[model samples]
Target: MGIKRTVLIDEPFPDLFCGLCQGEFWEIDFIPVLVPHFVFLLLLLLEILDDPVQVRCPEDHMFCSSCIGNYLQQSRTCPHCLTDLDPSLFQPSKFVQRQIGRLRVRCPYHEAGCTWQGILSDSHPNEDR
Candidate 1:
């Protein structure tokens, strides 16, 4: 087997390329142009996002319940913020509490030991009259 030698060619370098105005660009005479137009275009594209998005931690440092649950098994603390969020200690929000009460009703004659089952609206129809 014979070893083959390959020659690499450097692409032709521009000599007379105008930056601001067309002119010859010698090695030492060429100024690096930081085009603001491209950056402005990028900013314009970024601005096209209309809706706000919630931010979350990266995978390795995720602070969400699932991550914390997986990390500590049972102990619930945000991996990033260390905020305590125990599932066993979770309390129903006011909205949820209200909905629960709305969906349930006491006996019509609750004090008289009458135990009936119905929604609050049905149980309190007399109140509407």
Candidate 2:
């Protein structure tokens, strides 16, 4: 067999929040972190298979709960990757918890020279509460 990509789907999506700065996504903005769309799709599939269905933002840049709830009631597919969303497949689980919680990861833009890491929950700080 050829060499395999070992990128873990189980790992949490990187958070963009900064607890130290108490900043939001744009506020703590660094360089652009480019994730190939295909890779993002792969990760989303692995995540949704585990618990309640997840949705993407209108810009197709991030995942959101309320956005998904609203979108699913009208459409059965993700606005971003067009992944089919089956509400029947949604089963709420206490296991449903933020993967990174309040931690940070190398900025997706680390491929360049921007050294920044923050909370993933910071993606859409003004959405829920």
Candidate 3:
């Protein structure tokens, strides 16, 4: 019952990763191979922001919504700056979401022979394979 959404892309921007969990806001599958005369690097699958949120701290640290929420429940402070945290002050990161949506991704079942691939924004959770 977890978020199984996934996508394939080349190296992603470093900032897209959450500062708290050190996770890419999504599950990811990275594949790289080297043959005798060729280098084969398969597209990597990454989970695109599962409810991404941004801290109001001056550093503007970002984290997966669930990760921060759980952390704040125990200690009310920014993970990066230790600034006092107010869960109500957390804001959704539309900019980050848009950026992540721009990434191209293959079906989570690609390795199992599913050939579907497209822009993240255009993908539907209930897509018919």
Best by TM-score: 3
On the 0 to 100 scale, the lDDT of residue 126 in model 2 is 28
Q: How many backbone clashes can be found in candidate 1?
A: 0
For residues 37-92, write the lDDT of model 3, one tens digit per residue.
Answer: 21111122223345678878887777778767878778888877799977788898
**Highest lDDT against the true fold, candidate:** 3
Model 1 agreement with the true structure over 1-129: per-residue lDDT tens digits: 000011101111221111112122222212343322211100111111111111132311212222223455754554335565444543223332232223333443444554544543253433332
- Per-candidate Cα lDDT values, in order, are 0.26, 0.34, 0.59
Poorest 10 consecutive residues of model 2 by lDDT? Answer: 1-10
C-alpha RMSD of each candidate structure in angstroms: 32.5, 13.2, 7.8
List the candidates ranked by lDDT, beginning with the highest: 3, 2, 1
Off by more than 4 A, model 2: 1-25, 29-62, 91-96, 104-129
Q: Roughly what TM-score does model 3 have, to 2 decimal places?
A: 0.66
Q: How many residue pairs clash in each candidate?
A: 0, 5, 2
**Model 1 alpha-carbon miss at residue 80, Å:** 16
Candidate 2 structure quality by residue, lDDT tens digits, 33-121: 54432222113222221222333334323333444565557777766556766555543322333433332334444445545444543
Q: What is the C-alpha RMSD, rounded to one decimal, of candidate 3?
A: 7.8
- Model 2 has an lDDT value of 0.34
What residue runs in model 3 are displaced by over 4 Å at the alpha carbon? 1-5, 21-47, 124-129
Candidate 2 or 1, higher lDDT:
2
Please give the range of 10 consecutive residues that has the lowest summed lDDT in model 3.
Answer: 35-44
